[model samples]
Target chain A: MMAFIHHFTKTYLMWNEGPMIWTSDVLILLTSIGILAALTYFKKWKWLWTEWLTTVDHKKIGIMYLIAALLMMFRGGTDAELLRTQLIQPGMKLLTAEHYDQIFTTHGTIMILFMAMPFIFALFNIAVPLQIGARDVAYPYLNAISLWLFFFAAMLFNISFVFGGSPDAGWVSYPPLSELGFDPGVGENYYLLALQITGIGSIATGINFIVTILKMRAPGMTLMRMPLFTWATLSASIIIIFAFPALTVALALLLLDRTIGTHFFTIAHGGDPMMFINLFWIWGHPEVYIVILPSFGVFSEVVATFAKKRIFGYTSMVVSLMLIVIISFFVWGHHFFTMGTGANVNAFFAFATMLIAIPTGVKVFNWLFTMYRGRIRLALPMLWTIAFVPTFAIGGATGVMLAVAPADYQYHNSYFLIAHFHQVLIGGTVFGLIAGMYYWWPKMFGFKLDERLGRWAFWFFNIGFYICFMPQYALGLMGMQRRMFTYPANMGWNTLNLISTIGAYLMGIGFLFIVLQIAYSIRYGERDLTGDPWDGRTLEWSLPSPAPHYNFAVIPTVESRDAWWEMKKQNRTDEWKVKEDEIEPILMPKSSGRPFMFGVAFFVFGFGMVFHWFIIALVGILVVFGILAHRAFEYDDEYVIPVDEIKHVEVGLGRL
Target chain B: MTTQTNHTGEAVHVKHSAKQYIIGYILSLVLTAIAFVLALGHAMSFKPLIIILMILAAFQILVQLFFFMHINESDGPPYHAIGLGLALLFAFAFALMSIWIMSFGYHAQLVS
Candidate 1:
């Protein structure tokens, strides 16, 4: 019934959408009111702890980011499922084109901007600080703010459904389609404002991570000595710093065009649509690395740990990751092979795209060699890692094919491209994240997840993913386009679509099993965590289960690639520290409700201004300046950690 | 933690500081004001002025990076690496803008 209302409202708006809300908008209005109403009744509003929200602790922020991202994933995933079902039978009338439009757009928006990003960030929050032997990220309060801003953006994206409708202009929101005369709905408004908001948060987070990685390495842990995960993050964060601002500028330009008609990308007004495409892909191409490279890092660590071998070719792996970053910037043109840039341009980009495979292949070989001649433990995480290796390679092979300029003509906009991305994304990033979750679950929480349940989850998920996506390559070859809600049954796509949908359900069930495993482990699972339960190689495994707010009592130094392993081998020396180093009172940022309030401000200003709420926008801008001004004059005057206090704390390390 | 105290004379330091940020901002602001005044005053003859201001702004961002952002003063990685990092971002943005502009095939100059 709700879906029907959403569907009906969307079609009506497609025909006659306005700045104002229609009657169906009231349903969204009512549902949002209902959700907020429940929050009020339960008084969970107070439990929204401003103290916790603004704290500098990476773990808390990472977890919050994950929670927000999960909500987005659910919202995005449901949209996907709906689209798939609509596409199952041609001209089936299950959903109108407008309804399909909203689903596809929101799915891409939420998945990329919200789900994948925050999930990767969750791993960063949990690992980077701990891995680098830093007590906290470089700017912890900023970290908190970045997370809240992201949440605000995610919330604003969803809030569109309530106030009016969400972005139906597609995730890319390509113009003239996005211009006022064409869309002129709250849909594109949400797209610009939400993305602009989230893009700011992402950019700031990128800077924060990059600074942390560069500056906060433990003494003796030079760039060369850093862990693979840290190295991957360094490269990824570099991409983010350089890349996301292009998105920010692009979205800003588009917003200017749509809201005020400034003629940036409009064809009639001296604007260039190809400009938008170029800028978007400049960010978009590296955005793939932003997701995939971190996953590669995750798999490296997993393979090495389970294989009980030193990561083979550590220097080469780091060098390769760096090379990947350098090469990625030159390859943005490959995205627009269909734009008719001529064969020379196309061939140049095509070759650049394939060059990425070299460093990527090096990293792959290094991982495999790490596993060679070692006692390979077939842990669930390791199983996923193994499956991912071959699967991602297949995706890479297809990617190379697509990079061939002539071949891309046949493959562009087809299900083949879709199949290629999903193969890599699911097989690479998704699998790596799942592997990290399993590998670190016991380290993060006190208990180990049920291995039996983990195995079931793995097999089902791995098999189901292939079943779903492998057929899409063939579908692409047969000339089936993506984003079609319905196809002519004679086009030979119905069987593949049906099979894909079935596989999606199986994958869904597998996810459920994993979720169940996490839930059960949280409650009744066995707990024996003196924290280093896995006998892990990294410093993160040295800390207690569910690590404390202050991560390290004494910032541990490095003697070798595996700092913790080196410590054990050397018989637990204070060689972890430099000689005459006196413990200064390590100052941590104070917890304030400021980040949340600032986030609220951006939230109101972004969404409200998009809808042209003059007064609300005014208030929102005031709130932002108000918070920043209030924050600037004050300081974290609370000298919270005293020197003797830290020493005492260090003695009781693992107390958390 | 240390400044370039190795500068031979107080006049040299004073001159570098004066030219680096203080005059840099002034010159940038003047060029911008000139461009803005021309545009606002409706003078098509000041197309040269617009080009001049943009070039000035681009240089100003560089000046600020070197002096205010403290890039050129230090010989260490902090100075060079971060400068390089910022340069990389600039290069990517510049490359993207160039491609975008060129893609329209001189059609932008034709856009009203």
Candidate 2:
């Protein structure tokens, strides 16, 4: 019993790590306590439970996802600042090499998996149903499950900082390095288990959105007539469903290798690490498209709206989007062109990678054409969209440069590679998501974010982005290898690295301005009394801002592409108003605590697995299955909002 | 309660009889048993036996799709068919690419 206790304390507690961990533990503890105290003091637990946690409403789920994404961005951004600060000067001791490894790993993982994925999902939940003119997602309860699983998985991953330790074998967790022979700690286990849980959630979300978009569009809203964002969501969902399984298989096998001594990726026993790389990139390459495609969707919507014109070549845009999706799967080998896959294999992948540039270039031209010879409004969202085009163009051009297999040998693992990705990811995905948040802010809330503050945030972030990453390209060309904790001053990387670090801080400041913008807007921003704030063209704008929980009292019949715009043009906006006699009871999925409980159970199972506590893991699995069985057998899972109540809500919202 | 509104405003009340399920179950079982028996009996050389097993597996997949998954029934666009086609295409592509890529790694003598 003593030995068991000692083992548990040593492996799981991780109390003796250092001051950095101790500070994190204290901060996390205090934050939790403060949040609990505030919730109690406000007497809002019941409100929280009924309105947010147990909600099967897609809007509320989207809001929750948005909040989580923003918080994760703050976390990920902080990690970036720390990394930059560490490399601000040669041999800076702000962080030890060991700590730097963990931070960079978490930074990449959190930014991509937690930040980008949730940001996109939040947009998916918030906009897809609304844009498609549906009341809710096709599987609302399953949607709730997906959200909770992601939340809990994120919590599980973050807690590794205070508990077992963060995964330090980079975000990819490539094998041989990630194998038990080298990394015997529980950190890699945390990475695997957390990713596995979230991966399942992501897959369910993909399936849900596919079904929702495919089947739930309003009458006459054909596939081609659907909003570009919805189309993007559909394409991204397809990619998600196809791509995420590869990640699942890769992570699961690595876990098996860690826990059960498998030879799948082990070094000595006929295990091939290259297979892991191949499988990971098979998912990984398409995964970038999955995130960025949605941003492309956002840009299309924003450009069309601000340009006061229909999107230029809408069909071509969609064809190109699908082309990118198909091509994404074939180019995973470009990620490891230098891994000695032979000339023929490398040339094929390189060619496929470059082929992506054609569709992407077409999209850039389409956006430009959308804005050409049209009245352009410079709304905050539009500003981000306009910024994205030139930024992503340069990023895409650099990406093509890196796609050359022979040249990749020079740029591989260098600051140039890092700069290229951060360019596309931040310049592309982050910028687009931020634009989406601003575009839909009034739709989610009833008020617009403060424009002046948003502009400040935008310029700082955008300028800081160029200042930060542009130098890294030069640094990469100067032969600075990535993942290095520090450098010698004689290497002449000091000036560029210093400038990059400064730019990172500026971006951090910009992020702060955004938070301030949001906070100030909540109290003093302009109210969006009219739903069509931007003179938007999509079906979502047809409904009132902060639309009632039932969304549309009567589902609007879509007549053409840009259905709402068409309705407005025809002066038929009153079609949303329904007579008292026309009101019908609406069936909505019931609020249940099951998803949250299931997330908790999965968390327990994951945590137990991380620690190799078989008994605890078994109990968790049993509880998980028990909940599933209960859910399956239970038939009464939905409730109806009576006609009278919906009428009352419509009257209150002045939609009667 | 028995009828649900589909995408096209029609109420789709899909009902399946236990007989169909039993038939599907029996067919799946027989297919599996035949594959097992052939393998266990070593009834033919490796190449032919593998080819026959592959054929049986394909048939089993079709049976499952038609019987259990109800691939043909739809109220709107054939999303299920499109999804299935895409899935099969991706699966085949992934398998072929993995083999092609891994073969190169083997040729290069990168991994054991």
| Highest TM-score scorer | 2
- Write the residue-wise lDDT of candidate 2 on A1-656 in tens digits: 99888886566666666677778878988999999999999999999999998998999999999999999999999999999999998989999898899999999999999999999999999999999878889889889999999999999999998888889999999998999988888889989999999999999999999988887777888899989999899999999999999999999999999998888997699989989999999999999999999999999999999999999999999999899888999999999988887887899999999999998899889999999998999999999999998889889988999999999999899999999999899989999999999999999998999999999999999999999999999999999999999999899999999999999999999999999999999999999998889999997887788978878777778889988888888998877567788777887778999999999999999989998988888988899999999999978877788998998888887778
The CA lDDT at A499 in model 2 is 99
- Compared with the true structure, what per-residue lDDT tens digits does model 1 show for residues A1-656? 99887776665343255432354456667988998999799986766575366565788887777677667766776777777778766667777787788879998888888888888888888889889887777777778788888889888887776456778877888877888878887788888888888877887888778877776777778778888998898888888878887788888998888777799998787888878887888788989899888888899889888998889999999999989988887788888888876666777789889999999999999988999998899988799999999999999999999999898999898999999988998899889888877777776666888888988889888888888888889999999998887888788788898888777767777887887887878888778557776667888877777776677656676778888877867788444432234565655656778888888999999877778777998999999999889978875423367766766665565241
C-alpha TM-score for every candidate: 0.88, 0.97
lDDT of 1 at A548: 62
Q: For each candidate, what's the DockQ?
A: 0.14, 0.41
How far residue B69's Cα lies from its native spot in candidate 2, in Å, is 0.9
Q: Enumerate residue pairs that collide in model 1.
A: none
DockQ of predicted candidate 2: 0.41
The DockQ-derived docking category for candidate 1 is incorrect
